[model samples]
Target: MKSGHSGWVLAIARTLDAYGLSHEDIFRQVGMDPEMLRDANSRYWQEMISRLWCTAVKETGDPNFGLKVARQIRPSSFHVVGHAMSCSATLGAAIHRFARYAKLISSSAMIELTESDDQLKLVLAFDTGDMPVLPETMDTVIAGLVCFNNWIAGENVPPLEVRFRRPHPADAEEYLRLLQCPVLFEQDEDSILYSQTDMHRPVLSADEQLASTLDNMAVTQLGQLSERFSRRVRDCLLQQLEQESEVSRKATAELMHMTERTLLRRLKDEGTTFQEVLDNLREELAYQYLQRPDCTVQSVSFMLGFSDASTFSRAFKRWTGRRPSLAQHNGTAEHA
Candidate 1:
C-alpha cells in the first residue's frame, strides 16, 4: 500500500481542531487509526488519507479548507526532506530537491519541475490507481508546496500563476486571497508557475554541508523504504498463501488497500513482481517444510498453494534443480 508520513496526518488534525472539528472522530469515521498520529514513523495509507481529506472538507464546509491546512504546515511536517529543502542554495535548487525526494512524502503522488525561458512550473500529479483524487487533496498539496517555498525563501515568493485541473469554484476569492497570484482553474494541470528570476533567488537558510548530510540521509531512507515495501508485499502474500488455495493479484491488492495496477507498479519499482515474490516465498517454505521430518511432499505442496504434488515437484525442480523428494532426503538442496 502507498503511504505518507504521519506528519501530514498530524498537520491535518491540527487544522481540523483549529476549525472546531474533532479530528479523532473524523479519523474513526474514515476507518483510520487515530493513534497513528502518536508515532512519528507511522505512515497513513493513501486510501484512508484521501478519505480523511474528503471527510475534513465535507465536515468543515470551507471552500478554502485545503489552503487553511497548508498554512498550518511546518518544515518538520515533511521530515528530513523538508529540512533538506530549507537548506538548499536557491529556490530552484530547493524545488529540484523536493521533486527528487517527493516519494519520501507520498509515493502515490509526484511533483515535477519544468522550465521555460522565463518561468518555472512545478506540476503535481497523483497515481492513486483506481481511486478518485479529491480537489481538496490536490489543493492542500499544491498550496503546501507554495507555502513551503515561501517559508524557506524567508519572503513572499509568489508564483506567477497558479493553475488547477478542477473547475472554477463558486467563489474563488479565498484562492486569490491566499495564493496572492493569478489563479486559473480548469487548466490542463495543477501547477505553480514562477518567474525564473525569483527561483534563482538564494534561500535564507542555505547550508551546503547540512543540505548534503540531509540529502544522503534521505537517499538512505528511500532505499530502506523500498525494502520495507517489498517486505510488506511478501508478508501479505505469506498470509494469503496460508488461507487460500489460489491467491490472485487483485485479492492481494485489495488486502493492501491499493489497486492491482498500483501493486504491480510498486513491485516493479522494487525490481520484482507478485509472481516472483510468491514463487520465491514458496521455494523458501518448501525447504523449511522438507527439513521437517513430519511433513511430506504432498502435504507441503498443498501448504504452498499448489494444486498437486506433480506441479509442486516441477516447480521445486525449477527452483532448486532437484526433485522435492531428493531435497527432503538430502535435508537441504542448493537453490538454482
Candidate 2:
C-alpha cells in the first residue's frame, strides 16, 4: 500500500488542535489511530490521508483549511528530507534534492523540477490510486513548498506564479494574500514558478559537509524503501485505472519508462505477470470498494474499470465464488 511519512499526520493533528478540533476524534472518524504518530517510522496509508483531508475540511468549514495546515508545518514534518533540504547550499540545490527524494515524503505523489532561462517550475502530480485528489490536498502540498522555501531562505521567497489543476474556489483572496503571487486555477497542471534569481539564492542554513552526510543517509533510506518492480507496475496500473486513463500493457509500460519486453522480463523475474497483477489489483479493490457504504455494485464496477456490472460480477465470482451484492452485504456487516 502507498503511504506517507507520519510527520505529515502529526502536522495535520497539530493543525486540528490549533483549530480547537480534537485530533483523536478526527483520526477515529477516518479510521486512523492517533497513536500512530508516536512511531516516527510509521507511515499512514494514502487512502486514510485522503479521508482525513476530506473530514478536516468538512469539520473546519474553512476554505483555507489547507493553507492553515501548510503554515503549521515544522521542519520535523518532512523527516530527514527536511533536514537535508535545509542544509543544501542553494534553494535550487535544495529543490533538486527534494525532487530526487520526494518519495521519502509521499509515495502517492511526485515533484518535477523544470527550468527555463528565467524561471524554475516545480510541478506536482499525484498517483492517487482509487481516491480522488481533493482541492485541499493540492493546496497543502503547493503551499507547504512555499512556506518551507521561505523558512529556509530566512526571507519571504514567494513564487513568480502558482497554478492548480483544480478549478477556482469560491474564495481565492486568502490564496492571493498568503501566496503573494498571481494564482491561476483550472490550469493544465499544478505547479509553482520561481524566478531563476530566487532559485539560486543561498540557503541561510547551508552546511555543505552536513548536507553531504544527509544526502548519503537519504540515499541509503531511499534504497531501503524502494518498491519492487511488480509492485511499481501495480501502482502505475492503479493510478491509471483511478484516473480513467488508457489502461493497456503498452500504456503501463510507458508510464514505468520501460519497453514492454523489459517490463515483462522484470515482472517475470519477480514471478508475476502484468495481467496477473491487474486482475489481483482489481479483485482487491473490488472487495475494498464493496465495503464502503456509499458504493454500489455499479459504482464499484466503474471504479474497477470494468465495462459493466455483469462483467464485474463475473470477475467477482471468479475470485470469491459470489456476486458483489452478497459480498457488499457481508462487508457492511463486518464494518458495523
Candidate 3:
C-alpha cells in the first residue's frame, strides 16, 4: 500500500486478509465503501476515517486494530520509526524525537511533549494543514504511544491521565480499553500526562550509534522541512493566540515573517483554512476548560472569543452536536 490515509484504508483490507476475511465481507459488515480501499494515496475527511475504523472494529469484533497495525509494521516499515523511538534514553526524549520526526511515520499529526512541575505530558496535536482523516487522532496517538512504549519497555505502562481536545462520544470505551487508564474529555489539550519519574526511565537501548543512525534514517525518509515548517507555523499561531489574545491572519503572517497574502496563499496551498486551524486550537482549549470543574461555561465562552454565552453555546453545539450545558454536566459534549 502507498502510505497515507488511503493506505490506512488499504490496511483495513490487509487486516481482513490476514484474518482470513474478505474485503466484501468486511465492507458489507462495516458499511464502508470498498472503493475507498482502492486508492493508494487518497485522503478522506477526518471524521469519515474515524467512523470507518469504528465500524470495522464493531463489525469485525476487533478491538486491536490500532495495536495490530503498529506491531505488524516491520523494522524497515513505518515501524522502523518505532524501533528508533524505542532506542531513546528516556520516554520524554523518545516523545521529543517522535514529535520532531513524525512526518516520516505519517503526515497526520505532530506529537508534542510538555513537562511541568507536576507531570510529564505528551500532546498529539492534530495538523489540519495535512488534512488528517482521523477524527480520533488523539485516541490513535495515545494508543500508538502506549503501543510504542510497550514495544520499547517490553511491558505495559499506562498513562496517569488522558485528555481529549474533542468532546466525548460513543465508542469511548474503546479508548478506555486501549489505554487501560483514566480518560478525560473536553480537555483543554489532547494529551496524556504521566508522573515526571516516567521520563527518566531508560528505554530499550542507550546506544548512541543506533540513535544517530535512526535519526539519519528518519531525516532521509521523512524530510525535515515538512515537520519543522509546520511546527513553526503552528507554534507561532498558538503563541500569538494565547499570549497576545489575537490570532488574526495578518498577525499570524507577521509572526511567521511573511506577508498576509503569502501566508493565506501558502495555507491554501497546504489545503487548510485559517478559520479551521483556529477552530482546532479553540477546541483543544475547550477540552482543557471542561476538564476543570471549576471552569465555568461563561469563562470558557469568553476565552474562546465568543461574544456571549449564547453564541458560544451555539458554536459549541455545532462543534460537538450538543449543547454546552450537556458538556458542562458531563464534562464532555457528545460528538456530532
* Whole-model lDDT values for every prediction: 0.83, 0.84, 0.62
Candidate 1: segments with Cα more than 4 A from true spot: 229-231, 238-243, 246-336
Off by over 4 Å in 2: 227-287, 290-336
Q: What TM-score would every model get versus the actual structure?
A: 0.71, 0.71, 0.50
Encode model 1's per-residue lDDT on 180-232: one tens digit a residue: 89999999999989999998889999997999999999999888877776778
Ordered by TM-score, highest first, the candidates read 2, 1, 3
* lDDT of residue 259 for candidate 1: 95
Superposed by TM-score, candidate 1 places the C-alpha of residue 206 at a distance from the truth, in angstroms, of 1.4
Candidate 2 local lDDT, 1-336, one digit each (tens): 677889977888998999999998787655566887997766766877887888899999988888898998777788888899999999988888888888888887778888999999899987977678988888988898889989999989999999999889899999988899999999999999999999889999999899999999888878756756777888999999899987888999899898999999999986779987898688767757887888889888888888888888887777655577876735442211
lDDT rank order = 2, 1, 3
- What is the per-residue lDDT of model 3 for residues 108-219, given as tens digits with 9 covering 90 to 100? 5567777798687777765545234343434555666676676665567788988876667655677777777898877777777787777676787666578878888777
All-Cα superposition RMSD per candidate: 14.9, 8.8, 12.5
